[model samples]
Target: MKTIGQPPFYSSFFLATVIIALFLGISSFVTYQQTPWKAPASADAKKNPLASDAATIAAGKEVYVKECQSCHGKKGKGDGPSAATLDIPAGNFSTAATQGQSDGALFWKIEEGRKPMPSFKKKLTENQAWQTVVFIRTLK
Candidate 1:
């Protein structure tokens, strides 16, 4: 039994836990927001060799449906069933945040994913990845 003015022993522990949780949450949000997912300058320079013709777009759409629709949504709006489960928001392909990126940057990102987005480098060939970029362009 402590004095009325003083908090109990467990109170200190509870306060510490709350403070740590808040710190971690804030840090995580700030970290995710602060960093831009831009690829290397060299990657930006790389060009998409495949034409954006109907056949290429069609192939890309097929791949997107099979691979990305689970997380990126059927319309590429980042509202897929799995999107809710991720700590980070699945990219909305229609948004400028994604559409503004060059084809090469997008392709590199697909090749080298961040914490939540898995790298398709092993799963998809270079051509497929490039085609994915092309398909993403038509997302709007």
Candidate 2:
């Protein structure tokens, strides 16, 4: 038995555990605060998204085939091989709700590129990006 002046072995162990728990809790809170959470693209998206004309869609397809296919897939399904190694998974482009997102939103995403996705603003002209938006409208 240890005197009150000196902590017992179990007291030291308990103190150490409490210190570790405190450190981990603080670290977790810091990490959570540092991570940015992006809100969904549309707060109130249209019930029926705009449908681009065939001519525009065709122009957009050309741009997509040239610029986006390698990562987004030939069919815009986000299953391209390059997508596998990407930090952020490529978006699936076939669903109506997804493809239905506004042209402005799509253009911004293409221009800005999310995290692991590199921005194409410097690589492709804005017109090309808008055309890609048009092509996206045609996907199922």
Candidate 3:
């Protein structure tokens, strides 16, 4: 038996609620799209690690040529062939301003490249990444 004030089993109210929920979802999505992306804490500049030797640098350089030169440039000056067409732009390793990065910071950046650049964490070994960090510090 139905109650005195109860409506029928089918109702327009259900449809309205779904529509409102979808609209709110889309609005939230649009707002999210407008927000800018921030770098991860690992990318922080303060924790940069330094490399200690010529051998490490040389090893890093070899890795760079094989893995990074496409975007980071031959000397890390960010003049590589692909650098010109990148939407976000590549890093300039040759400049002193760029060289000011800490070793750990550089290592972090290489391990997890910013957007557009792929992460080498899986492709390259941790040691290889550190070697590359050593090479990057020499880019003056």
Instruction: Report the number of the highest-lDDT candidate.
Output: 1
Ranking by TM-score: 1, 3, 2
TM-score of 3: 0.62
Give residue 101's error in model 3 in angstroms.
Answer: 1.9
Question: Model 2, stretches more than 4 Å misplaced?
Answer: 1-55
Q: In TM-score terms, which candidate is top?
A: 1
lDDT of 1: 0.89
Better model by TM-score, 1 or 2? Answer: 1
lDDT of 2 by residue, 1-140 (tens): 44788867898999999999999999978754544423356622422233577776787888888778878898888877788877555767887656666667777778877666678999988777777877876676
* Candidate 3 residue-wise lDDT, 1-140, digit = tens: 55887775466688788899999999978764544333455566544244468877778888989989988888787888888787665757776556765666666767776567788899999889888877777777
For residues 1-140, could you state the per-residue lDDT of candidate 1 as single tens digits? Answer: 45888888899999999999999999988977757677998988899999999999999999999998989998899898889998778878999898888888999999999878899999999999988889999988
lDDT at position 79, candidate 3: 82
The predicted structure with the larger lDDT, 2 or 3, is 3
Better of 1 and 2 by lDDT: 1
Estimate every model's Cα lDDT from 0 to 1. Answer: 0.89, 0.73, 0.74
Task: Please give the RMSD of candidate 1 to the true structure.
Answer: 3.3
Cα error of candidate 3 at position 124, Å: 0.9
